[model samples]
Target: MERFIETLMYRSRWLLAPIYLGLSLAVLALGIMFFRELFHLIVEIPTIAEANMVLMVLSLIDLAMVGGLLVMVMMSGYENFVSQLDIAEDEEKLNWLGKMDSSSLKAKIAASIVAISSIHLLKVFMGVKNYDDMQLMWYVLIHMTFVASAFAMGYLDKITKH
Candidate 1:
């Protein structure tokens, strides 16, 4: 009975499989939104200011970073918690697949967040005339928080490795 219970407990990890699959749908949705924005940018190119165009580009970049983060977390989290993914040798494969452990995944996530925050802060700065000083200060503070968190996480990871 004890052995059976342990086996059942281990198999329960499969419950997360559906959640990871759901992230794939999210990736698809983001892809659609990205292309939609791209089309809009193209159509408004002549009418949009250069700064506005830059801001749009930054927004797209932010989306891409977030999409990447979601994919990484979904794939790595599933593999680490559920089961190994078997792929044929001849098939195309991701170099980092099966390589990122939970710690690495956390670091990657933190780094991605910092990158997204940096892009957002840049956009805010670019549109400084549209925002009050307090708002701009808050944006900078938020970005700094992300930067500090990433740095601390990296430091902790390094210490743990040693």
Candidate 2:
């Protein structure tokens, strides 16, 4: 029974294989969405007023953040469960790849969440006239919570490592 359980545990890693492939598909989807947004921005260039242009730029920034999140998940997930990418010493490499274990990945994800939240917060700020004070305060509070959580996690990780 013990031997059988060990084999099952070992084989569980293969389950992650499908998840990684799914993430690849999701990445492709994000690419299509990004390009779709890009085309819209191009078409709306002349018609979009200056104020709306800011909103359009924010949309682009949101897409960029999502893309970054996808890349981080895909690369780190592959390295952690699947296999190390055969990136060479001289090859152009993302600095954070391979170095981020699950713990670091969690922290990075938390930080990214905070960043994306900030972008949203900015949008709210820009549209303050449309938002009630109570709603605006809640958005600020939620963003602060994310920031605090990320900082606490990073501090804890640092302390535990040493």
Candidate 3:
């Protein structure tokens, strides 16, 4: 019975394999969404509608940034936690893959969030005529909160690593 249990534990490491692969599938879904957004933007280009075009452009940028963030996290997290990706010697490889451990990954994620937030804030500012001053202030505050939280998290993580 003990040997059987040991075998189970040994094989369970591979169970993580599937979970990591699922992350790739999620990445695929994000790609689909990204392209859909892109096509929508293209379709709307000729309408010359009253909608805030600048804000809409910022929104598209924000979505692309988010897609990038998802790809980084999904691929890097899988590589860090599950297995090293076997990129062939002659093939192009991700420069930062395997190099970014969880700590670095957190920092990258934080920075990405800040970038995405900045885009969102810009969108809000561009649409300022439609939004009240209070709503704009809240948007700015929420983004600042996210910035502060990310800073604190990176600092604490750094302290622990040493």
Candidate 4:
């Protein structure tokens, strides 16, 4: 019975496979939204003010960063938690695909979150009139918190590795 239970527990890792596939679907949705935003930007380019154009471009960048984060998380989480992906040697492959372990993936995620937050904060600053002073303060505070957390995590990870 003990041996059977161990086998069951080990095989349960497959349960996460579906969840990772869901993340791919999310990436697809993000792609659709990105193209939708791009279409809007292109359509409005002639009449759009320079500030508004900048804000729109920033928004697109934010979406792209988010999409990249999602892909990274999905692929790395799958590889770390589930079975290794089988890829042909002749096909195009991501350089970091099989190389990222969970620790490195976490660090990358933290850094990506900070970057995404920075872009968001920039967008908010570009349209400062839309937000009050309190909101602006909260945005900066929240972004700072992300920065601090990522830094602390990296520091701890480094110390732990030594």
Residue ranges of candidate 3 with Cα displaced over 4 Å: 1-13, 49-51
lDDT of 4: 0.95
lDDT of 3 at 138: 96
TM-score of 2: 0.89
- The weakest ten consecutive residues by lDDT in model 2 span 50-59
lDDT of the structure predicted as candidate 2: 0.87
Candidate 3: residue 133 Cα off by (Å): 3.6
lDDT tens digits, residue span 90-147, model 3 = 9998899879888898998999999999888887776688899899889999999989
**Candidates 1 and 2, the one with greater lDDT:** 1
User: Which candidate number maximizes TM-score?
Assistant: 4
Question: Which residue pairs collide, candidate 3?
Answer: none
Return the lDDT, model 3, position 105. 89
User: How do the residues 1-111 of candidate 2 rate in per-residue lDDT, one tens digit apiece?
Assistant: 999999999778878877887877887887888788888889999898876778778877887887788789888988897778898789999988879998899898998
**Candidate with maximal lDDT:** 4
Compose the digit string of candidate 4's lDDT tens values, residues 41-142: 999999999999999999899999999999999988988999888889999889999999998998999999999999999999998999999999999999
Order the numbered candidates by lDDT, best leading: 4, 1, 2, 3
C-alpha lDDT of residue 101 in model 4: 92
Residue-pair clashes per prediction, in order, are 0, 0, 0, 0
Per-candidate local distance difference test: 0.93, 0.87, 0.81, 0.95
Ranking by TM-score: 4, 1, 2, 3
In Å, residue 8's CA in model 4 sits off its true spot by: 1.1
- Where does candidate 4 stray beyond 4 Å? none
